[model samples]
Target: MLQMDPMRPLDPALPITPQLTQRLRDRIIRNHLKPGDRISETEIAKVYDVSRQPVREAFIKLADQGLLLIRPQRRTVVSRIAYQDVLDARFLREAIEADIVRLLAKTRDDALIGTLRAQIELQKRVHADDLETFTQLDEQFHRMLADAVGKAGTWSFVEGVKAQMDRVRFLSLFDYPMALLIEQHTQIVDAVEARDLDRAEENARQHLRLMLDYLPGVIAANPSFFDLPEGGLAPSVNTPTLGGEYT
Candidate 1:
């Protein structure tokens, strides 16, 4: 189908095109819209109750994010999940966030800890079924860490480079228990508070790798949604494991 499932309806927190774009992007990230599925401006416009102009604009925005492949004089299709893209994102995030945690570990910021703990508490209140809120708070927790370390711009850069990884992450969240992720965040807070650089870094690394552990099952569930990892002989799903290349 052209349109995909939404965690909920569009928030309308922004303008028409931006709002529609966010809705469509959320669907793409969550795997409600599988790769290679054709979607058109008219189709989406009708659904969002917006004009074709805004919908067309939304398509361009999504295309920029690597979520939509826009072809001239043809319908836009959701892009395939390239395993290499996911790996790149994971590697980059591990590099950036682990250091952010390290920096925060050196400083004494009770306010920062309180803020992170608040986000975690909010996460705790989010029902297991509330993927939308869970995802928002998840992003907030990470972004807040960057802010605490005066690396908010760095976090934005990491986000810019990791669009593909973000999509893979959201898709994989379906299989992972959110509660476990929350607990991991709690451990990270504890490690940082204790000024345990090694422990904090390890926690960050493990938390990022959590998605890789779930990738095989995502591929198994929706093979069409993914592509082979770079330099790999074949897609891992058909193999015994995802292979050491990911490690």
Candidate 2:
């Protein structure tokens, strides 16, 4: 099961369509709803206690993100993992972050250094069972590195394109050892502290490639979560069954 559940009531913060989109997106990325798993609008609408209109809207949105596949006269299924998309995201991220780390290494800001070390400490301290928290902290550490080099904008852009890779990361989390991630993070920090741009760049590249290394085995193990390209179909709005709807 995903650590988070989508069936809960909608958060008050967002509009209905986006709210539903996020819940479904989280589930798909987190592998709570594995790829290739059929998702019935009727069932989801009933489970979330929402009208079919919002759920259908959310379906189109997720399909746009390459997370869901909508087919006419067939069941809606999760999109299969697209390795090409994964590679593209990683490539863009490396191009952006490789420079971020290089620049961050050239400067020696004590406060930033302290922050990097503190984040690494937090990474090490994160319990093995809490993979989700560790993943978030990992993102923060990279964001901090980007901000240090005034490349926050670059990081934002990389994040915007990493939706597919994010799912691969979540899938690979349990399949591979987390210790390697912690160790890699530590090495990256060590290189930064030493002001070694060459080493830092290499470490960043290697760290980003880590997911790619671990993903094949996971995909093989969870073969059902993927599909080849296909056509799409949109459904007309209708009232939902089982009557309750969450945002």
Candidate 3:
């Protein structure tokens, strides 16, 4: 059993499985339950004061997400980060969001621009150590862009694919370049405001690719957290042309 702080009591009215799944996911991503750490349904049930059935279901859900590895009559351990999964997630995001920004740039909407700028302001105010709040705001910032262009469902798809990237992100937050990211956000907003479709697309692509630049350092610093071996090759991705047609 992993020793940690007591969980806050779950509400009786809510469904326990989804809540438990999400909380457990957060624990894994935030490193409270680290990679390769063995966790058991029986032990988790004891911590949450819930029955093992819900805990088992929750574990299965996370297993499907590649966060847990369940085995018969063996200890279940947290999955290490898959470098390819992270790259694939970034590729999908860059493809989807590049088009999203281009569409938003084609039309000038002061209201949308204002909302995004306000979001950046809020992001700036987050304390450097408050990564959880910053992460939420960051998601909101991108989701708002997709929502503005009536592509909320498309953004939902992005969310589904980005879990692997999120784990890497949370781990990298200790040395996160918050100011640089905020500046990138500002540039993205500025491009859209100016109706620079190509620039907006480019800005979005560059922002999404920041992980590509930092991932190597992160892997080196915490080799045990990732599945990629030392000297493993990162995936090579072709840069998409600005305003390129989506296949």
**Cα lDDT, all candidates:** 0.79, 0.77, 0.87
Screening candidate 1 with a backbone cut-off below 3 angstroms (N, C-alpha, C), the clashing residue pairs are: none
- Compared with the true structure, what per-residue lDDT tens digits does model 2 show for residues 34-126? 777788878887777678999899998888878989997788988887766776787778767777888878996778888888888898888
Query: Per-prediction TM-score, please?
Result: 0.80, 0.78, 0.91
On lDDT, the leading prediction is 3
Q: What is the lDDT of residue 237 in candidate 1?
A: 28
lDDT of 3 by residue, 50-77 (tens): 9999999999989988899998798899
lDDT of 2 at 172: 74
Report the lDDT of model 3 for residue 117: 96
Better candidate by lDDT, 1 or 3: 3
TM-score leader: 3
Q: Higher TM-score: candidate 2 or 3?
A: 3
Clashing residue pairs in candidate 2, if any?
35-225, 48-246, 49-244, 49-245, 50-245, 80-226, 80-227
**lDDT tens string, model 1, 4-78?**
443445556667877787778777877778799889887886676667998898889888878999997977899
The segments of candidate 3 whose C-alpha lies over 4 angstroms from its true place after superposition are 1-7, 229-231, 243-247
Against the true structure, candidate 2 reaches a TM-score of 0.78
Q: Flag the better candidate by TM-score, 1 or 2.
A: 1
